[model samples]
Target: MVQEGLERLMDRIVLAYSGGLDTSVAIPWLAEKYGAEIVTVTMDLGQGKELDDARERALALGAVRAHVLDLRNEFARDFVLPALQAGAVYEQRYPLATALGRPLIARHLVEIARLENASVVAHGCGTEKGNDAIRIDLAVRALNPDLEVLEPLGVWDVTKQEKVAFAKKRGIPVPAGADSPYTTDVNLWGRSIEYGVLDDPWLEPPDDVYVLTRAPKDAPDLPAYVEIEFERGVPVAINGVTLSLVELISSLETIAGVHGVGRIDLLENRLGDTKSREIYEAPAGVLLHAAHNELQKYVTPRDLARLASEVGVRYADLVYNGDWYSHTREAMDALVAKVQERVTGAIRLKLFKGDHRVVGRTSPFGLYDQDRIAQSADTRPSLELRP
Candidate 1:
């Protein structure tokens, strides 16, 4: 049975497809229910060879066309770098990796929709109970109101198991099941794990939830030292060797991961109106943010540092809440860019078991006054009755 209003409202529908269980079902479901031709877009933000398979799957699952765009550089330079510059962390924990990526994906969805002359954009965002639906929907509305956004699973009464069943019944291929009991999303910046037993805050996340790191105990016996170079707050090199944005981050991930540098567990406050236990593996992002923060302390004034911290939190909130296209976010970006002008330098970091700290920092623009603070002419071993 055709859905009542969809027939008139949508002709061709462009979908932000992931080739996951929900989105695999969406290709057929949208066609059957809305009689709309489906165009699928999958972004490659350094998720590796899976995208080639995903594109193939999207077409096999009944998409009229599938586009797989490599957006790694743009994602890093435009979205990820700005987050790093502001030291953006949601709730002071999450590096906003997943949050930051959604807006860029949403923008691409609109672009595909326009090129395809589609009247509607759709996502397989599973439930209204998650932040992704709100983020993707708000971005679509903000960027292109002419295109109606659809969440097929939000209205459909299908459970996860049923969706899997539907895929099997419909002859759509599904990835083999794993014993690992977590839902995961990975990109160049980090990996985020949620769902399954992770919903319980009291239970410690199983070691399998982590993808980019070893357990601190299992890390190498020796500590690893890394030096990151920054130009205006964006990381550009590792140990003085220049690299592209993506390569720089990837190198840090390996160097930091060897010593167990990034692992975070939080009972995060979600935009969906609940607190959720989320685990993140952000070796590169964590190390870069730490390096950037330490370097900024050398060059940034106290008052500006305090204010930038405040701006970072607000920036995190906006990015997390799907307000990335808003004027307020643009204004905040301007402030962050100004603050980053003098944040050019290098930071040496010592990475050990589950912890890392800045061991040294240097910058031509540094505000540290070593001669006065460390070796003053009038310094004395003991002061008598100064008070």
Candidate 2:
């Protein structure tokens, strides 16, 4: 105990702060536990302008300094675009939005830790059963193994009620909706809701839990049609109007959400062979994936197409299992990029009542030979086989 206390006096910790109770409480707890000075890093990864207040909250909670970086553009270009082009949907369903965001956050956490010369970096992934802990830890270790990765919540091992009580006792301003049963994570790529009644896999997700998408039954009576254009596997336009990647995705999220597309409910296989009941709203991800996938069929040859699909599944697994910075993922990305060379095209999709389907596709590199494929039998040459 004497030696442990001595080590605490020299500690400086950098924490990933979200304007939430878990993180807010972590500030005081980490300082008290390690007798350390706290430096907080809050990232704006399409969460919104509200994250600005997180810095103030961190300071109020006894953090020595706070850094908030706007990483939305980098996230779209460096993370979302590559995952989309690679077709990285974990378990053939989730777009891996939450999973994708973790590594980027972890990368920055290490950067901030290095800048502060902190001995330890921490995050608020509270549950032992969840995957974010593994994701953040792996990314941190991969980037800079010398720094200690701290998970205060993991060590605290307290229930949500306990956490709330602890926050209140410490005079931490718990965010509004702190008592809400459902826990959610939101970003540009998607929004995920879990816990509360959602823990019952047999129960339907309450309508209140969803934000980005409307209920399928509540969607409009008339069907909607959209044209999405891609350049080398990246979505570049919507309905013939060119836009920035962020703008394109945001627009599609609204459009597809209005039509009640991209609501996913699944039993996700987390790391360590555990399972989780998860609900996700990813209007833009679903639409873009549908369009990009259909366009690939039109442009990619059969053998290469098959190979790309296989690589995509592996890529998805790697992302889900928290191997984002692995050399294997880099190699797979090279192949995915090679396959996407000809995936330049436009795909027309019909959307109605939570359903989206590809209606048509056109591409300069399309391999479909209409004359040969659509020819009648009489117009085609007959071949005879020897007996």
Candidate 3:
């Protein structure tokens, strides 16, 4: 039955394989169901060792070809930088970590589809009516309007448990425990956890659930002070130590995570029309956003900063709703680029017990004139200024 379906449309298929449960199962399922030549492409957006075994796992799962592209620098410069410059935080908190990564993944999927000349591009994104499906569909359609976009899970009229049972019956190796207490997404920016016990807002997140951030009570006794230097809105140095983008983020993550500086718990509206309680640990993101905002206080005028903040929220929504490649997003990017022109500066931050606060900020192109403001006649008391 599945074999016949594969035989009919199995000439070639390009899959955005993550080597996760669904994707790992999809590779073999597509090959068996469509008998198509499967080509897998995994984008290395700093997922660490999970990506290390991606090619091997893809081949092991019966993919004819596999490629893992290192997109760290491109992801940082192209996606992360623009979002950071715009101060695009969703719901005044989220850094749009996974949301920012999806478009790049879709772009790579399109490229791989073209390279493989695959008749169809497929993803393991289930019919959850979430941002993943929207992102992939929008990106693929924009890049190659004629290509076929396939979503197996969307059409599969089965529950997750049923899918697991079918895979097991077919001798498909599934990840340990088909059901997990939570669903987690991790990247360079942060880690977000949803589902399971989190559905109840009243319930406190288990201590073990937090991986990247130290517990507030467990944090160091003394405050840790650090200085971050930015060039055109991107961090280039930490505590006088110059580093590359990746190095800079990594360094900050280590420093901030230890102090429990970035943990957020919120009830956010998912794209799927549900109110979800999500917990995120984004130490570096917290530190960077605070430091950057502080730096802007010196470099950008009050009105410009306010406008940028407004635009940032809009930009965050667009990205979250899978409109990364939209015209409005491009315009917003241009506006952010202009704002970042003078956003070079150093921000001094103090971290202690799950908090990262700005203590001082300075910029070469600062719009601030402290001496003039201090001497302003408006600041003088009426009695002191009496003629």
Candidate 4:
């Protein structure tokens, strides 16, 4: 139960509601416990039916109002494209999907709070004592420092199972089935699953946990070839077909998912002092990142690429740790903008089960000198390498 003083402190609260077990429970809890009016805001970053159900569920959970904002174009044009341009990847494998989505979601939550005249902004993120809470709170503070931030799960003195029981006791329908052996977060860039059975790093992930890519053994026998075109570092076309950013990414997901081209299982250092096992399925993102990196090899200088590589890791850390709206992230973005100026090209790739091999690449800005390096050229003895 909430303390009387805290309840008086928040008469109107704007919640980052997803209609999930945590946020759904939060809606009624804030109302009943604090006498607060709950206004739920759900951001649409191309998570599909999940967003739709969240809106419906928020209203059903006694929220005074529910707002679903379609931020797909913003997500693709702003977040995804910047990462693509920067060639940002966490540890050269994971596509910061949910990580990239956080700042935008928190931004909207703050905006809604301001518009609704809400004194507080609440989120479902539990007190994991990690970067996510820090990230959301930071954004909230930056946007509206006066708006008190409330995290029900952060303060709630109960285990996850206990929270589920509390929801059930209140007649809130949790997602069916006992929770999967892993906790999964999904968005446009990709899906990441971890925890539960995944804690045992030695054990292989069960088949049921995968949502995007097919298992390697189940992939097709023949290889598929794809050509990707880029302009100023953003993917514009695939296989010579031009598409909107969202369509292009979606098409790549379908194509690459079939070939089992993107699946990663690794142990990563979390914001806390522990290391956790994580599995990711990011077919399109993996393909694009590879192609983008290969293309950059031709256009970008080695020194700039090296610097960008370091910045890329820091950029990924910021996203993963929820500092998306911070000065460090903005500085990283500026660095990426400068480096991406020359990253214009097209790359051809051969895709097989769980593998993507770049066959060829072309760019108007290519640094490769065909005349000097051609296989048919005579071996000219030289005292020193020339630019």
Candidate 5:
């Protein structure tokens, strides 16, 4: 029986399927209940080889047309870059890993629905109380109000054990469980780890929970120095090596993770009721965010820097709430873009023992002189001002 509050029927539905446990179950559930052709769309945001089997999995599970899009570059440029410039971090700890992907995925789902001439789009998001269901629904509605959004799990009262049972009953193959015992979401930008034993805030996250970053204690003895160059707020080059955005971030994640630079185990306040303890491995984000923030200070005026900081907090909130398409977010992005015009600079940082220390920074619009700052100490340099 189809759950209440989701009664619109259609000839076909485009599902934002990830080939995960939830989505695998959704394919059959949608077919059984809606009696509509299921078209699965998987946006591949650099989840590695795990995505190779998505098309096969979707077809085997009951999808008629399975679309797998390589959206890695789009994810980086469209979503991650703005957040990077705005210094958007939820709760001052999370860099909005899963939150960032929702809008982009919703956009694709809507486009697929249009091409397929399907009035309904479906997703395997968590129940009604889950945060992602809100994000997906809001995004789909905002993009195309003509289309109807369906969330099967949002009304289906099924526990995890029951869901597992349902998958088994449907003959859906389950991925082998890891010993880490945590739910994980990964993309080109970052990784999110939560649930299970991580719910206890007092208990530190175990080493096995982190795959992108090494333990701080396990980091190499020697300090690794890296130079990151930004052009109008977007990362462009690393150590004078000019690479595409995707390549630069991927290289940085590897380099910084090996030095134990990006690991955050913090209590996150979710969009829905209740707080969550989530562990994140965002090696590149950790390195780049620091460089970008420091570069802003070097280029922008003191007053503007303070205002930008405030705007950054608001930007984080807007993204956290999945209000990316809202007018307020557009205004926020305008301000962030204005600030970023002057945020071009190169920041040198030392990565060691799970921490990044800014070593030096240089910008064409620098507001201060290093030599003058060193000479005056606490006193303001009486140097002549030049435009």
Candidate 6:
């Protein structure tokens, strides 16, 4: 059924597809609602083999064309690394993995829309009840306000099961794991799980919700230690071996996941002025932020360090709220960049069952001077004479 005013208004639409159920259903739905030709874009941001047949799936769902982009390297170097340097952690728990990916994805949506001569851009974000839909909307408008944006689920008012039925009725194949009540978003930086049983804030997340980490009880009995080296606040090496930014993060995720080191369950404040229970697994992000902060503190002065901490919170908020392209965010990035100039060093961490702490840090710019220390044993003589 075509919506009254929207029918025929959109001649062509470019959709940001995730190869998930929501997006699979969207290809046919968008075509029906607006009588438009639909082109789907699926981005690869280190989800491994999960995206193997995304293009084929999109084409089978009646898409005029399908685009599968490999954006992992760009995602890491351009999006993830800057947030790592800025120390952008939402509410000190979330590393904003999904948040950081939204802008980059939206940017490409606009580019694809222009190439396709699309009058509108669409997304499978589903609803405005959560953060992502708004993030997509704002980012697209920011990049190109002239392009109309559409969200099918915002108006569809259907349950997940209903969506499954809708897809089946149209001969669109339901994605694996569609029957599961939980909703998940995955990227290089983290994996976020929510909805269904997770909406109950009091209920502990089931073990099935986690894929990147082991249960704390099941982790190795012996503690594992890792040495991370940072150059200008970006992690460049692991245990004395240099790696690309993407490789470094992937290596840390494996090492830290084995120790069950990065699992966060929090009651998060959504941008819609509502609170919701969210679970996130970001092993690499956790380790890197801790290690980077340790080395940063070793070299940074008190006032500058404090300022970075304050700016970091705001930076996190802006990114989470979908203001990634704002001039204010750019200004904050400049401040963070200056802070990073002195943040080069190495951090050694102890990773024990679901816990990680920085046990050692060293930097060429470190301010501490051991020989000039005024210890209890040696400092009394000079002070007593003055008194």
lDDT of 4 by residue, 244-300 (tens): 999899889889999998898978887868787888888889999889889987888
Per-residue C-alpha lDDT of model 3 across residues 1-387, encoded as one tens digit per residue: 121123365698888887767777788777777778889998788765467778888898889999999998888888887888888899998998888888888888888888888768888776653667777787778777877777767656576777788778867677763587677777788888877788799999998788888999999999999999999888999999999988888788889999988899988877867776889988888888888877876788889989999998999898888888889999998898888889898999999998877888888898877888988967886776557
> What is candidate 2's lDDT per residue for 11-35, written digit by digit as tens?
6889999888788889998888778
Error of 1 at 205 (Å): 0.8
For model 2, state the Cα shift of residue 134 in Å.
0.4
In order, candidate lDDTs are 0.84, 0.87, 0.82, 0.81, 0.86, 0.88
- State the number of backbone clashes in model 4: 0
TM-score, candidate 4, is 0.92
Off by over 4 Å in 2: 1-7, 374-387
Candidate 6: C-alpha lDDT: 0.88
lDDT by residue (tens digit), candidate 5, 58-98: 99999999999999999999999999899998877778878
What local lDDT score does residue 103 receive in model 3, on the 0 to 100 scale?
88
Candidate 6 lDDT by residue in tens digits, 284-305: 9999989887788889889999
Tens digits of per-residue lDDT for model 1, 1-387:
123344453579888887667788889998888778899999998764467677788888889999999999999988999888988888887898888888888899999988998878888675633688788888988998877888887768667778778888989877655223567777888888888988888898887777788899999888888899988887888988999999998898888887887898988888857788889988998998888988887898999999998998999899988899999989998999999999998999988888899999999999988778767655857757865
**Candidate with the larger lDDT of 1 and 4:** 1
For candidate 5, the TM-score is 0.92
Clashing pairs in 4: none
At residue 261, candidate 2 shows an lDDT of: 98
Give each model a TM-score.
Answer: 0.94, 0.94, 0.91, 0.92, 0.92, 0.95
